[model samples]
Target: MEPTDDFYSAYDDPTGAPTSMTTMSCAIENAKHMHTLLASLLLGRKKDQLVRCDIDASGLYFTAHSKGKSLQIKTSMVSDLFETFQYFEAEATSFRICVNHILDGLGVFGTSAMASTAVTCSYSAQEGVFSMVLTDDGVLAECSIKTMVDDEHNDCSLGVFERSFEGAKVLGHMILASNALHDACSEFHELPTGAAVELVLHPTSFASSSDDAMCFRMQAHTPTSSCEMELHKDSTAIVQVQVEATIAASFQWTLLQAGLQVLPVASESFLRLNAQGFCSIQHMLLLGSHRAFVDVLLCPDAA
Candidate 1:
């Protein structure tokens, strides 16, 4: 279905000010599209969850830290994803908002057969309100959500496509089809809580037959037993693989699985890791003619 076009106009700003000074001002008419795409970013229970939203001329970056878990996720909704996106400030601005509130106030129902729901979002520093105006056909609904300070401490490098954070030298990396990787992780669904999953990479032997030359594998330990799956370098599921040295690291099962939320919709899965056990799994999502990305980073505690 063709997405509706309901761009936010200047008059929609609750501050009554022009877009020049607004920290974040954007609109998208595909309410259902936004809802499904963003819902994949939720880490845990949505209520009271905080997500750092960074807005620049290009688009929005949403970074969320998993509570008590050393994992960081950064997802982007580029300008192409929006109908009308504007960054009025001279420099980029960042703010923390309740993801639950933003998702709940989207007003996505009753939009399938009728006019699509157009969502206009902006932050007014004057009243300290993140205003959202939902418009569909002749209907309009306004919502105001509180903004908070973004005080995150973790770091990641997938945004730059370099080594893992903290200067860890990349030890192994692989690019593969998202659906294939998603199927490989299916065992995680059965692992009990607090389980640690291991990413293993090595050939069955230094020089083996094509059928036995596996290079990518994932192993999981449940409460009672363990399960593992291996992928050959020439496997149809693998797009590319580069592993000179052995790579075997265990990480918190929960932290690793969080990134899988986007796998179903992603076109490709990029995995890179360093000796420090810091790993990055990037999900490449296709958006219309453009593309967006969701990067998940696992930190020390997850090791």
Candidate 2:
């Protein structure tokens, strides 16, 4: 069974105590935008899949980790992204919610009907329950979901993410059209599950002796098949490439496909790898005039 907490342990910050999910709720005026955002957060169709949502004054943050925690994806919808936001607590509060339920309760899963929908989301810490109300064209629907707490989850280290945040200073940084990644992976269909995708970042001079400082290439291979592709300055698929030093690493193809699938509605993507070979990709999402972002982090595959 998953870990569940009681209100008995939830303390107020006044006397210097840690806070849980209390007084955290909001009204999402743009339910359509939120539906798309949660669609990106959905890993698989499994009904039991969970995501950790952190609520603060800034906005609501959804963080999900893979089965083995080898991959992590974080998406943020700022306060302005929602129609109305409210959090009475002085400290941040978070709880695990079944993403599938919220997505299904949305009612406008894949249609314009979502445009007419308004979502009211709130948490009941005392009862350890999360609830949502969907009002679409006066037809109201309500959903109640249980919450979970895992004390060890919040302790994961974020040191590796720092390198990706450092911008051009990282070992390799590539700004590519997200569509290109999807297309590239499609071309590697023969590389079955568990196959590895090799990414190489090098100075263009090393290959073409051109003025372009950096070049990015990928190789998808398995025991029976192999394929190679390169994104050049001449291609519209690539926007920018900067590399202080050439680096090459292999990452599980399946692990990356998960992140790539999240950006079907996005255009640009930022990919970076640090000296330690950890990968972070920021997929820029344009949700209804407002710009939201999804960040995916991956651990390098053993060579």
Candidate 3:
């Protein structure tokens, strides 16, 4: 009897008393029972330092405290628990039959009262590693003897798949995080109100390291003056502006980098108009590592 035929035949009439039908039904029931037991064990009973269990459509998520820091565990693919078990077994540990339910269920050939099967598995944490034993019987199954180090951040120690925060920094095939971008822009102040400015950014160099210093040449344009700026990795930035003062006029300008407007360079320097009717004042500003050079542009007027 083929496995498919046996399954259909068992479903059609479970009481047929055929040996193949009986075995097929037994295996299906065993798998179902195993799933039920795992669900119950994961969702039930309070254990040491285990505070919260949150089950979502994705999988099981839980938080526990170990050594004054919070640790999180996420278990996915639980609906196909047997397949998941097999997957883990293939990678790390093999299932051991401490007791066989099938042999014990036959009774005459068995010696164990519990009719349980257990497998030992090990996992790692930052400070240390731990082991666990998962047992299953025809009636019930539970993960027991789980020992882990009391560390605050256990997620850092899990394997790639078991990680609670996997691929969190991945954005559009890039490893850059939003916070990194935000931090880079935070050095600039807001754009001045109603000031028309044109920004030009030039990438001076690229390096192998993600954190390498990038050199940029920026040009900011205003109605009466244009400023050129140079930014480097050392957080040092400089701006040189040539202004054409018609009547000792005062206008506000802002420096923008990575979409962030930084503090405006306040200038009270007098502009001595040249024969071209424009005066140029050269200035330099230094910024820290959390900033990047994107472009030089004028901003809205400060009305």
Candidate 4:
């Protein structure tokens, strides 16, 4: 079962002594912008599903686990997004809270307003509550949602994916505008179950093929006004397909479709794959004053 933020206030200890606490507070001038970007991270059926959020001097990080935690998508809200940023912790501080609660709290300030809503978000470890104060047009609203304690046994780690990616043999790496890739993937989105979407990389062109017995393939060549394709084996540099060897990998069609979610907000994207067909898509989303990186790793379909 997934974790969720509670609606009730945290129960105090029987001793009545306030326990050790960790607090992080920040003020933002544009709540709507933050709310919009954050809403994109919610996916599960539970409207109040918990998401791991980290706040630090550098930025705010949010991560959502999907596919039984095998897949993770993370986004960042840099300090530039805040009008006043103040965080204190012995180490990186992380909390799990319901994303919907945060959205609802921020959404109180309707978009029709001429100016952005001023928001102050604070959380205390001892209280286990995420509090938000929103002021719009001189009206103030305060919201408090209880946070979830971490479950060590249920926590997921990215070490497996990281290690696999680090050791996989790079077959090809390509770069393209987010829209361009999304447009291409749309053609293969309807491939029947068990069918695989194949990507063939040429030195100067790229093609996405689907094995539907129709032999349908959508090809894009480099030097096009919007799309750029590179294929190489040297992972250290921008990879380009070798002239002597053309590389191809087949991934589940549905997995590639997930990349489309990033297109609406991202400016550009990068695609990389290994000989074993494992693939990763990285996109940089454009927030108002800051930017975020969203990466999705998809396992390949069996040959």
TM-score of each: 0.82, 0.83, 0.18, 0.71
Clashing pairs in 1: none
Q: Write model 2 residue lDDT over 96-120, tens digit each, in one string.
A: 7777767766753336778777777
**Ranked candidates, highest TM-score first:** 2, 1, 4, 3
Give the runs in model 1 whose Cα sits over 4 Å from its true position: 1-21, 110-115, 152-166, 203-212, 300-303
Candidate number achieving the greatest lDDT relative to the actual structure: 2
TM-score of 2: 0.83
Q: What's the C-alpha lDDT at position 216 in model 2? A: 81
Looking at model 2, residue 36 earns an lDDT score of 76
Q: Candidate 1, 174: how far from true, in Å?
A: 1.2
TM-score top scorer: 2
In candidate 1, what are the lDDT values of residues 1-303, reduced to their tens digit?
111122333344344234644677788776765665566668856466677777788988887777764777777788888888877777877767777666676743453622277777788665556877777776666767867655555323225323345487677788889988888778767887688888876633445446547788788767697978888877877887776578677887777777677887889988876777778888887765667788887764444
Q: Scored by CA lDDT, what does every candidate get?
A: 0.70, 0.71, 0.25, 0.61
Q: Model 4: per-residue lDDT, tens digit, 12-103?
A: 32222222553777778878767756765666456766677877778788876655543556667777777766666767777777788888
Better of 2 and 3 by TM-score: 2
Off by more than 4 A, model 2: 2-22, 108-112, 153-169, 204-208, 211-214
Rank by lDDT (best first):
2, 1, 4, 3
